[model samples]
Target chain A: MNLEIILHAGLATGTVLLFASIGELLAERSGILNLGVEGMMLIGAMTGFSMALATGNPWLGLLLAMLAAGVLSLAHGVVTISFQADQVVSGLALTFLGTGLALVLGNGLTGQNAPLIPNYDIAGLAAIPFIGPVFFEDHSPLVYLGYIFTPLVWFYIEKTRPGMHLRAVGEKPVAADTMGVSVYRLRYFYVFVGGCLAGLAGATISLSVSPGWYSAQTTSGQGWIAIGLVIFAQWNPLRAALGAYLFGALRRAILDLQGPRMILGFVNPLYINPNLGFFLQMAPYLLTILALVIGSRAAMRKRIGAPAALGEPYIRGERGL
Target chain B: MAFPISIAIEKRTADVPRWMPAATSIGSVVAAFIVSGIVLWLIGSDPVRVYGFFVRATFGSWAAISDTMVKATPLILVGLACTVAFKMKLWNIGAEGQFYMGAFFASLVVLVPLVPAGTPAIVVIPFMAAMGMLGGAIWGFFPGFLKARFQVNEIITTLMLNYVAILWNNFWIFDRWSDAGFQMTPTFERNAWLPRLSDLAREYPIFSGITLHLGVVFGLLAAVVVWWVLERSRWGYEIRLIGDNPHAARYAGINIARNIILVMMFSGALAGLAGMSEVSGVVHRLQERISPGYGFTGIIVAWLAKLNPFGVVLVSILFGALIVAGREVQPSGIAQMIQGFVLFAVISSDVLLRYKVRLVRTRADQNAAGEAA
Candidate 1:
C-alpha cells in the first residue's frame, strides 16, 4: 500500500514491458508490424525458466531464451518478409506457434524451482531521497539495465547511420532499396532483434520480476500490453519507457487497491467485496484502451503516425507502401 | 567451385488454376501433420500412436463422433464469427471476450429467470439466443466505434476488452451467482437446456447415449446464412471490397465506418451465439473456462477454411476431433501445437499461389546450352 513500494515494484515489472515494446518498436521501425510479441514473450519465459532449472545458470537461461524467441521470430520473418504473407495473419499465427511451443516444452516445469536473476542496490544512488529508494534501491538487475537500455535505443534509432537506414527501410523501402540498402535483409534482421527483445522481456518476467512459470499465465497478455505501449509511445523509445513504467505502476496500484479497507475516509468496495476485485483487475486493460484512445487522438492532432510503411510487405519491384 | 544451381522465385502475373487454392490448403494440412509428427517425435512421443489414438478416440465410435460434433458446434459459430469480421479486414481478436459476454447474457435467462418459471423451450431458447447476441454486440460495439471514430487500432482494443470481459464474467460467477460458493452457477432446469438427441432416447432407442444437440443445427444454419451474406448480398460485396482495397471502396462511396461497426457487431453476435450454444447445449450451466480456447481456435479455423462459410463447418469438425482427442493426449499441448503448424503451413503455402519457383543452372550450364544451340 506504500507509494515507495508500489513504485519500486512497478519499476521491476515495467522492465518486462520495456524490453518487449522496444523490441516491437525495432521491428515496426523496419516496417514489419509483428503482432506475435505475446507468443514470443511466452516462449521466452518458458525457455528461460526451463533452461535456468536445467543448467542452474540464470545467465545461460537468459541467452537461450533470447535465442529461442529469435529463432521463432525468424519464422515470422520468412512468412511475412520472404513469402510476403499478410503480416497481421502471420503475426497471429506466430502467437499460436509460440504459445503452443511454450506450453508443450513447459508442460511439467510448473512448480519447479530455478535460478533467478539477482537483485542489487546502487551504492551511492540508493542513499538518496525518495527518488533514490524508489528508482535505485534493491531491484532486479534487469530494471537497472532498462534505465540504460531506453536511452541507448533512442540513440540507436534517432542518431545513427544504421538507424537512418532502418528508418528509410520502414518509411520508404523503394527509396532505401535504391540507396543499396538490402530491404529484405534489414527487415529480417530487425524482426529477429525484435524477437530477441521480446524474449528478453519474457525472461525478465520469469527469472527476475515475478519468477517461475505459470504456463500461459506467466506472460499474461503483458506482451500484448507491450504492443499497445508501442502504439501509445508513438514508436519512440523514451516515450515507450515512460509509458511502460507508468503502466507498471498502474498495474501495481490496481493490486494494491484491493488491500486497503478504507481510502480517504471512506470504505473500499473492492476490499469489502473481494469478488469486485475482478473489476479492479481489469484496470490495466481498461487503461490500455484509454491510452490507445489518447494516443490515437494525439497522433491525429499532431500528425504523428505509425511508420509510413508499417504492416506492408516489402516485395522487390512491387508497387506498394 | 560455385554452386551449379540456384533457386529463383518469380511473381505470377496470371491467375492460378481453379483448383490450386484448395489443393494448397489440403497440402498444407498434410504438411502440418507431418511437421507436428516431427515435433512429437522430438519430444519423445510416438506420433503414430498418438495420432492413432486421436482417430480412435474422436471417430472410433458413434459416441465419440457425437462428442466431436458437440465440440464442433461452438467452433462452427465462432469460426463463422471470424469469417465475417476477417472478410472485412477487421481483426476481431476479441471474439473470446464477446463469447464470454454472450454466455453471461444468455445465462441471465435462467439465473435472473427473465421469464417466469417453467417457460416453454420454444419461447425461452430464442429469447436467450437474442440476449446472448445483444451482449456480444454491445461488447463489440465499443471497439468498433472507437476504431471507426478515433482510428484506434481495433486489434489492440478488441484484445484488451477480452480481458475485461473475462473478468466481468468472473465477478458474477465467483460472487453473485456462485452455487454454494462454487465457481459456477447451479444447473438450469431441463426447459432451459438445449434439446439433445439423448432427449429422444425413449422414442428412438437407437439414439440412446447420443449427446448431439440442436446447436449443431444453429451452426449449419449460420454457415449457410453467412455464405449467402458474403456471396450473394451487395453488402457482402461491399465488405469484400473494403477488405481488398479500402481506397477504392471509399471512392465507390462505401461507408467504411458504418460497415466496420456493423460487421464487428455481426461477428460478435456469431461468437456470442457460440457462447450461448456452449452454455445451453452442452454445459447446461454458466461457468468459467467452459471454453478451452475455442474463440482463439476459431481464428485458425476461419483462416484454414479460407473464410468460406461451409469450409468453416468442415474445419471445425476436424478441430473438434483434435479437441476431443486432445483431452487424453499426454503432453496436453499437442493439439495446439498441431494447430500452430497448420496455420504456418497454410500461410507458407500461399506463396505457391502468388509465385512460381524454379531451379536454374549457373553460367556454366547456360554456356553449355548456348554452345549446343
Candidate 2:
C-alpha cells in the first residue's frame, strides 16, 4: 500500500480513461451521444491486439484500431445524422455491431499475448523523490501521449475559433447555421475525432495497460465509465483528466483493499466476506450515478454549463422554439 | 449545389396509415437479411444455405418450435418491460440488470430454504414471482426516482445500475450461494420449478420431452394484459401523452413524476417476471450466465414491435428463433450480427415511413439530358 506505487498505477489506469473520456467529450460537445463507446473500444482492442500480434508493431496496431473504430463510428453518424434515427437506439445497435464483429474477427486471438508498448525510463527524473518515481520513472509512451494530448485538447476546445463554432453547433445548430457554419460538417468531424480517440483508448488497454488480447469482454465496462467521466467532468477535457485519474485511483484502491494482508502473522483481512469485493468494485459506477444525480439539478447544470442541445438531432430548415 | 442521384428525405406532415410501421418493419427485416447476406458472401459463407439451416433449426419441427417458444418466453416479458418504459419516453437500459435482480431474489426464496419442502407448487411459485417483481421494481425505482426528483438522465442511470446489478448477483453466486466451489447455488426444489410440457410428456406420448414450459403461456397472457392496459387504461393514455410531449402532459395537470415511477416499476416487474421464469422454468438453478443479453435484446423487440403488446409477442418469437437457430450455425456471431443489422435497418428505415426521398439529378446528369434532348 505504498502511496507512490498506488499513484503510479493510478496514472496508468487514468490514461485509458483520459483517451476515452476526452474523445467522448468531443463527441458530446458536438451534440452526438455515442453510447457505443464500449463496443467500439472492444472492437478496437481486438483489432489492435491482433494487428500488433501479427505485425509486431504496436504503433501500426494502434493506427489500424483507430481506422476500424472510425469507420464504425461513421456508420453511426450516417444512421443518426443522415437517416435521422434515434441516437440512443442507433448507438445501442452500433454497440451490438461492434461486439458481434469483434467476437467474429477475434475468434483466434483470445488469451494470446501481444507485444506491449514500451515504457521509457527518465534517468534524471527518476531520481527526484515521490513525484518522479510515480509519474515519470516508468510508464508507457502512450501515458506520456495522454499527458500531452489532454492539455492540447483542452486548449483546442477552449481557445480556438473552430472550438467556439463546435460549441455553437452543439448548443444551437440553427443559430450556428444562420452564422454560416456548417453544423453537420462540424458535428461529423468532432464525432469522428471522438471515435478515433476511443479507439486509441482501446489500444492503450490492450497494448500497454493489460498487454494482451482477450475476448470481447476485455474492455469490460471501461467505455461506459469513460462516458460517465465526460459527464462528471462537465465536458471539459482538463476536468475529465482529473475525473479519470480519480476513478483510476478508486479502482486501484479497490484492488489494494481486496488484497490479502498479514500483520505480525495475525492475518487480519481487509474484507473477510468475498462478496464485499463486488460491492467495493461498484465504487466507480455508483459514484457516477451520485455525480449524475447532483449534476442534473438545474442550478448545478447551469453552473457547470452543459450543452443546451446535447442529444437533439439537427435538421435543415426546421422551425422550432 | 447540384448533385447526381441525390436522395432528399423530407419529413411528411400528413397522417400515416396505421399499418405503415408494420409494413416498414417487415421491409427492414428483409433489408437486414440482404445486408447480412452480403456480409456472409464477403466472409465466404453461403448465405442461402446458412439461412436455410437457420429456418430449419428454428421452425422445422414441433420440437424446434417448442425450443423457440422456450427462448421467447423471457423475451416477451422483457419486451413488454421495454414497451412500457419507451412509451413514456423513458429509456430503461437496465432491464438486463433488473432481470438479474429479479433472478437473484427469486433464487433467494428457494435457495435460502425459506419455504418447507411440502409447500405446494402454487404457493411457492407465486411467492417467488412476487419476490422477483419486488427485486426488479426496487432496482427500477432508483433511476425513476432520480429522473423525477432531480431530472437525472435515466439512460445513464439505468445503464450504470446494470453493472451494479450484475456485480450484486456475482457477489451472491460467487460466495454465499456457491454450490461447493461452483459459481452457482443448489437446484431449487420440485415445488419451485415451473411446470413444463415435458412434465406431462410421461403420460402423454404426443407431448414427449418438449422443453416448453408454462412460461410461454405466462408470456402470452402478459401480452394480452399489456395490450388491454395500453389500449384501454387511463394510465396508458397518460404514459402515451407523456411520451408524445411531457410538457403538454404537465400542462394538462398530469403527475408526470409519479407516473414515471409507477410505469418504471411496472416495466421492471415484467422484466422481473422474465427473470423468474428463466430461473424456475429453464435453468432450475441460480448460476452465472443466466441471461445472454435478453434484457438488451428486449429493446430491439420493443422497437421492432412498434411498442405494440401483440407485436412484442411476435417479435420476441422471431428473435427467439434467431437465438435458437444461431446455436446450429458455425461462428455463432451470425445471429448476433443479423440482430444488430436488423436493429440498424429498422432504425434507419424509420425515415422511410416519416419522409419521402426524392432522387435529384446532378448538374452533369442534367446537362447530359439537355444535350440528348
Candidate 3:
C-alpha cells in the first residue's frame, strides 16, 4: 500500500527481468528472434545450482550456467540462422530440447541445497548508518550487474563498431552484405552472446537472487517475461531494466498482499480461503499477454517497439520468395 | 564470358527434380544417425546392441507395436494440424494447449452420469470426442482471428494459451484432489473406453502387432481426409497457391485472410482431437501430464514428413518407435540424445532443399564454359 514498499518491490522485479530482457534485446537486434531463451534459462538455472552445490562456489556456478546455456543455444543459432529454418519453430523446438536436457541433467541437484550469493558492503557507503543498509545492504553483485549493464549495453550498441555491425545486420542484412559485412558471422555472434546473457539471467535466479536449487519449472516463466520485456523496453536496454522492475514488483506485490481474507463461499462462508489465489498467481502471465498485445498494435508497436528486421532471414543478392 | 557460365549454373539449380528434396532429407537423417551412433559410443553405450534392442523391443512384439501406434496417434494429428496451418504461413504452435482444451471438454462429457446404462455405447463415445474437437477448433480460431484482425503474432498468443490451458486443467483437478476422492485420475465408465482391437488383431496378421483404439483409425482417416482436401479440393489448391506465392493466389481470386483463419482452425481441431482421443481411448480419463509435449513434437513430425500426410504417418510411426525404444534402453538418458539429434537434422533438412553449396574455381571463362562444374 505504501509508496516505499511498492518502490522496493519494483526494484526487485527490475533485477530479475533485466537479465533475460537485455539478452533478448541483443538477439532481436540481430534480427534473430530466439524463442529458446526459456530453455537456456532453465538449463542455466539447473547447471548453476549443480555447480554451486558441487564446488561450493556461487561465482563458479554462475559461470557454469552461462557455459551451459551458451552450448544449448548453439543449436538454435545453427538451425535458425545457418539453415534458414523458420525462426519461431526452431526457437520453440530449442525450448523443448533444452527443457528435456535440463530435466535429465538436473536429477542430481533435486532436493539438495546449493551455495547462495551474499551481499557485500560498499567500502564508504556501508558506514552511513541509516541510508546505507537501505541502499547497499541485502543486495548481491548480480543486482549491480543488472543495473550497471544497462547503460553499458546502450553504449555498446549506439557507439561501437561491432555494435553497429550487429544493428546493421538486424536492420538490413542485405545492405550489410553489400557492404561486405558477414551477415551469418554477425548473427552467430549476437545469438551466442545472447545465450551467455540468458545463462547469466538463469544463474541470477538459482545462484544469486533466489539462491537455491529448483527444477524444471524453477525458471518458471521468467524467460517469457524477459521476451515481453524486450517489447516493453522497445529494444532499449535501459528501458528494459525499468520494464523488468515493473514486472518483478507486480509479482511480489501479489504475494505480499494476503493480509486480509474473504469468505470461501458466496453466502457467509465457514472459512477464509485462497481460492482467489489462482487468479493472483496468473497475474504476471496475464500482464505479459496484455503488454505484448498493447506493444504490438501498429499505433503502439512502433512506439513501444519491435526490432524492424526481427525474424527475417537475410539472403544476399536474392530476395526470392 | 563467365557471366554466361554463371547463368548456366543458376539454371541447373532451378532444374532440380521435385523428389530430390525429400531424397536429401532422408540422406541427412541417415547421416545424423551415423554421427549420433558415435556420440553413443563415446557415452559408453553400444550403438549396435542398443539399436538392436530398440528395434526388437518396439517392433518385436504385438503389444509393443500396438503401443507404438497408440503413442503416435496424437503426434500425427497434431503434426497435420501444424502442417496445414503453417503451409498457409499461419503458425498455430498452441496445439498442446488446444489438445488440452479438447481433453478438458471431452472429460466434461465423460463425467456426466445421466447416460442410461443401456444407452448405445457407440453414440455416447463419438459425442464425447466431438466436443473435444470443437473445443480445440474454437481455441485455434481465436488466434487466427486475432492475427488477421489485430496483426498480433499467432506464435506468442498460442504459446501463452498453453499456460492458460494448463492452469484451466489445474483449476479443475484441484477440486478433485481432496482425500478419499481420486488424486491422479478419476475413472471413466467402462463404456467410454476406446474399443480395443486386440481381438481383430489376432485375426489379421498385418494388424497383429497393433491393438489400436478408434483414435488411431481416426488419425489415419483424418490424414487421408486432409490429404484429399489438400490435393483435390479447391481450398487445398488455394492453400498451396498462397503458400507458394500469395501475390499469385490473390491474382487468382483466392481469399488470403479467410484461408489463414480457416486453415488454422481446422489445424487446431485435428490437434484437439489428438488430445481428446488419447483420453477417450488410451488413458480413459484426464491426468496430470496427459501429453508428453506432443504438440511441440508435431513440429518435428511435420518437418520430417515434409508436410505430406502419408509422410506424417511414416515419420510419426518412426518417432513412435523412438519413444518406445527410448524407454526400454537401460540408463535411459541416452535416448534423448538420439531424439535431439534426429530433430536437429530433420529441421535442418530445409537448408539442403534451398541451397546447393558448390566450391567455385577461378578458371577462365573458356574453361568454365566447357566444364559441367
DockQ of each: 0.56, 0.53, 0.30
Docking class of 1: medium
User: How many clashes would you count in candidate 2?
Assistant: 2
Query: Candidate 2, DockQ to 2 decimals?
Result: 0.53
Stretches > 4 Å off in candidate 1: B363-373
Residue-level lDDT tens digits of model 2 in A99-175? 87777677778778787788997778778889889889789888888888989888988899998998888888888
What is candidate 1's lDDT per residue for A149-184, written digit by digit as tens? 999989998999999999999999989989999888
For candidate 2, write residues B1-373 as lDDT tens digits: 5334555555677988788899999999999989888988887889999899889999999899999999999999999999999998899998998999999888888978768778999999989989989888988999999888887778888889988998889888888888998988888889999998888877897788688998888799899988888889998899999999989999999999999899888888889888999999999998898998899999999999999999999999999999998877767577777888899889988887877666666454343112211
State, as a TM-score between 0 and 1, how close model 2 is to the true structure. Answer: 0.95
**Model 2 ranges with Cα > 4 A deviation:** A262-273, A297-303, B1-4, B362-373
Please report the candidate that would top TM-score against the real structure. 1
Which stretch of 10 consecutive residues in model 1 chain B shows the poorest summed lDDT?
B364-373
lDDT for predicted candidate 2 compared with the true structure: 0.85
What are the TM-scores, per candidate, against the unseen true structure?
0.98, 0.95, 0.87
Residue B200, model 2, lDDT: 88
- Distance from true position, residue B54, model 1, in Å? 0.7
The alpha-carbon lDDT assigned to residue B77 of candidate 3 equals 93
Residues B1-373 of candidate 1 have per-residue lDDT tens digits of 3877766676688999999888988999899999989988998889899999999999999999999999999999999999999999999998899999999999999999899998999999998899889888988899999999999999999999999999999999999999999999999988888999998999999899999999999999999999999999999999999999999999999999999999999999999988999999999999999889898899999999989999999999999999999898877777888898899999998988988766776565343112111
lDDT, candidate 3, residue B334? Answer: 49
| Clash count per candidate | 0, 2, 2
